[model samples]
Each structure stands twice: as structure tokens, then as C-alpha cells.
Target: AKIKRVKGPYGKVHRGFLKGLTLVWSEIREVIREWQIHGQSVWVTGHSLGGALATLAVAAFGEEAKPIHGLYTFGQPRVGGKTFARNFDLEYQARTFRFVNNNDVVTRVPPRNLGYRHVGTVLMFDHAGILQTDLHFWNHFLDRVVGRIEDLGKPGTDGIKDHNMA
Candidate 1:
């Protein structure tokens, strides 16, 4: 089937806004129907385009349907417009997680004007990027108390440099 683009905060569909999400939802259903022949399960996650499709696929699965195993995405831009940005996942019950790096700018594609913020704690990979603020001091103090100085994603072998990309 043919596809048209959605309108994003920028020119249009820069991040696959929900302008035409219903079509994608239908396509996902087709995959599920076809996959049922094997009696297998489906898990969804993505960094960019895959993330957009995952979001729409799970949402289209309906409220009572079994929630997908997990929803993980990195450097994923805003999926919908100004309104969906606020409450799109209100009723959805999936384990949603986003891994964002300080310098990885793909997460803010189109750079719209708004106040949406990542809910998870920032796993600071580079301390140099942070300002010398009171909050930083507090976090360091807490780290000392807990005896865990490095974030889970900050280890030298954590591949932050490789995977912290767009």
C-alpha cells in the first residue's frame, strides 16, 4: 500500500508524527495476523523509525490486550504533535524506557518549542558536560552514600560512545 507523510513540528513527519498513525496501526495488525500462524510472541523496540512504529503498534493493540514485553527506544523524536506529546501513553501499560545521552541530539529532532521532558534520570556519561550546580553535588553525595559512583551507562566499556549515537 502507498503511504503519505505526517505533519511534524517541522516541515512534516520529520519524526513520524501520528498524523497518519492509523495506517501504520493497520499494517502492524497485518503482521500480527500473519505471525499468529507460528504461534509466537512479538516484542517491539527501536531507536528512531522503529520506535515510532512500536509506539503506534502497541497503542493500536487496545487497552485490554496484553501489553507488549517492553518498549525501549533511543534518540527517538516526538512521535505525535503538541497534544500527543503530553498524554499519548496515559492509558497504555507498557514498560517504556528511553536511553538518552547528553550529546546525542537526535532525541530532539525538529527542535520544537515545548516543555516535554524525559521522565527517567539522566544517566550522565560525561561529567564535563554538566554544570557545577547544587543538584550535581547532591547526586554525587548520594552516590557516595550508596557507594556507586558511576552510572549504569557511564562505565568505560558501557559502549556509551558507540551507542550514545543518534
Candidate 2:
């Protein structure tokens, strides 16, 4: 069967791919639950569309039984209206770092100030940002400094790919 060209919002000159937001959030929640790691802080990080979607998921968890712990992503684009950032910032009470490379245009779309109240957002502008040497160290360190959250694995090697998150 030939693939039909669906037009409109999901098409050209229109926001054709803005639908299915709820589904994405639902799946993210389910996966976190499946992890079965409760009472231990959580961090939602992603790249590109994953970042926007993950942000939505964290926002959805706001005021729930379990609140979002942190957020760190790269190459992520804007997801919703200006109010989105403001509202999300208000709802989320955690460390949020949004990395953006100068060459990556994905983080520069949809314009800024969407009626949302964001405390602040850190934008990383190079591949060095993704450098993880301590794996999940900074997250744990932050958790300790902030709310005494349970710590994860030991610090990874210096300059290690996963440790750069620190």
C-alpha cells in the first residue's frame, strides 16, 4: 500500500506533528514506574524531540505522588507556548539544565517567552557539554546538597563519557 500524504497541522505550512502529546507523557510515566526505583530521585534527559517530550512528562508528574527530580537534555527544541516554560518552571522544583550547541538549530525554534515562568535555563554550546566523566555524580551530589535524596553508583572515571554530566 502506498503511504498517503496527510496534510494540515501534520503537513506543510501548518503544525502537523503537534498531536499525540498525551500519549508520549503516558509512556514516559509508565516506563519510570516500570523502573521500580521509588524514593530515589529521577532525572529526565533527552535530545531533540526527546527533550521536549521528556519535559512534558516531567511537567505532568508535577504535584503527583512522585515529583520530577531533575532535567538535563541537549539539542532540544521548544515544545509549547510561552506559558509553557513559565508554567513548567513553576511546577517543577528541581535542577534543570538545557544544553544547546551553537550549530544545533533545533534549540532555537518557536521563539522565546511563552507566558511561562522559568527560573532559569542553562544552555551548553559545545560537544564538551555532553562529556560525562562521573556518570551520574553531579546529579547525586546535587540531590544531597538539595534534599538528601538517595545516592546512585560511584563516581565514574575522569573524562569518562558518562561522567561529563557532572
lDDT of each: 0.48, 0.49
Q: Residue 138, candidate 1: how far off, in angstroms? A: 11
What is the Cα-based lDDT of residue 37 in candidate 1?
53
- Residue lDDT tens for model 2, 1-166: 2212222111111122234445465676787776646555677887766776666566656635566678887666666544555666665534777765433445555444432122226554333344223325465344333321112243532223222233
Residue pairs with backbone overlap in model 1: none
lDDT of prediction 1: 0.48
- Span of ten consecutive residues with least summed lDDT in model 2: 5-14
**TM-score of each candidate structure, all chains considered together:** 0.50, 0.55
The C-alpha stretches of model 2 lying farther than 4 A from their native spots are 1-20, 34-37, 63-65, 113-120, 126-166
* Candidate 1 local lDDT, 1-166, one digit each (tens): 2132354322233233454455566666777757755677666677655666566555556332644555666656555544444333454433666555443445555445443333212233333344222347566445333323343445553223424552
* Model 1 misplaced stretches (Cα beyond 4 Å): 1-16, 19-25, 34-40, 63-66, 112-166
